[model samples]
Target: MSTPDPDPDCPSTPTTTGTETYLSGGCHCGANTYQLTLPAQPSPPFPLVDFDHCTSCRRTSGALLQAWIILPQSWAVFHISSTFDQSHTVYASSVVTAGALRKELGGGEPKSLVHYASSPGVSRAFCARCGTHLVYSRVYEEREAGDGPEGEGDGEDFVGVSLASLDKDSLERAPRPLQHTWWGDGVPWLKEMIAKGCEEGGIGAMEKLEGYQ
Candidate 1:
């Protein structure tokens, strides 16, 4: 997919409150639904962006890396009351040392954050039925233990959801992605574009290799 253009007049500061545009999206099965409120201009700490070269994300989405939009934990809403069957099948890709992956995957953990082994401490959640990826979270060790990999105190919670899986037109007015990450795992041609600061394809090369896979 082509990257969307960034708003020229967008601002860099974060907003505490305003009449922002709200958009909604859900899974193909409609089991998972979410709503996001975007600023009229570029808001620092805006929710979504593209992630590149994340191994678990690449495998899960079958794409170079998943597009992640961050939603305010307060503003984001999930409704699985009626679709529990579809919602329950969601899988946790890696093993957790403290608890069962399923238990660690859900809410209510003191310092829980979904994690993928490739990106340790980074947690990812996805649909169990159609395999639609949902969100990713990470532990907040800074506030918890003063300084440590494993947290000891209460940590802030965060999630990154796949923009493509959202309901239609939800991101119609959102800002374009701002950065690319994990470029090391990105295919060679893609790496070249990054080196040259070009925003176009390495897709043709990827396509050529598809037949072999």
Candidate 2:
């Protein structure tokens, strides 16, 4: 499904607050969309950004490296495209609070949104039709022994949004990777390549391509 031109009633522009900046993103097919409110500087560490290389993340995303921008559940709002015509016209859309979205995944509300446990207690949400991985989340009981991947279950009542799903402008404005997660699980060659890229003169000294000499 494709998102039609934004109806005045459904403005797609990003907004901001005194201390927060808003960014928007969605699935490739535009079946699902969300807004993320982040701090202008830094706060509760909610808007945490990091690169992940765990086996589960690699397998689930089919990518060598994955980046996640995490925040509190209350900091996001999701829009589900519900009504449309044969011409791919979006006639009606509904807003789903992050809490409600979490509770209704794979059940009701936001029919296009679905999720599955990539591992015990950890659910990954994606678009049913476009297959765009959107959110990662897990809940824990008080004093419960929550153990899994390096970055999973480290926080409470938080959801991690895939950096890959952010829109162009938002992605460009997203924060830099704060750290590397599950570094040991990364492929050896890929790790070497990344290390080289980080070295002072390594990237520029490597073979030049297309536009560069």
For residues 102-173, what per-residue lDDT tens digits would candidate 2 score against the true structure? 676756443767888887668888877678888887665522455533344555567788988887778877
For candidate 2, give the lDDT of residue 157.
68
Per-residue accuracy of model 1 over 140-197 as CA lDDT, tens digit each: 5422345321232234344566777664455565556777766667777656755655
**Ten-residue segment with the worst summed lDDT in candidate 2?**
142-151
Off by over 4 Å in 1: 1-18, 39-43, 81-120, 142-155, 193-213
Tell me the whole-model lDDT of each prediction, alpha carbons only.
Answer: 0.50, 0.74
- TM-score of every candidate relative to the true structure: 0.58, 0.80
- The numbered model that scores best in lDDT is 2
- Which pairs of residues have clashing backbones in candidate 1? 25-167, 26-167, 47-69, 47-70, 48-69, 48-70, 114-122, 114-123, 115-122, 115-123
**Model 1 global lDDT (CA atoms, 0 to 1):** 0.50
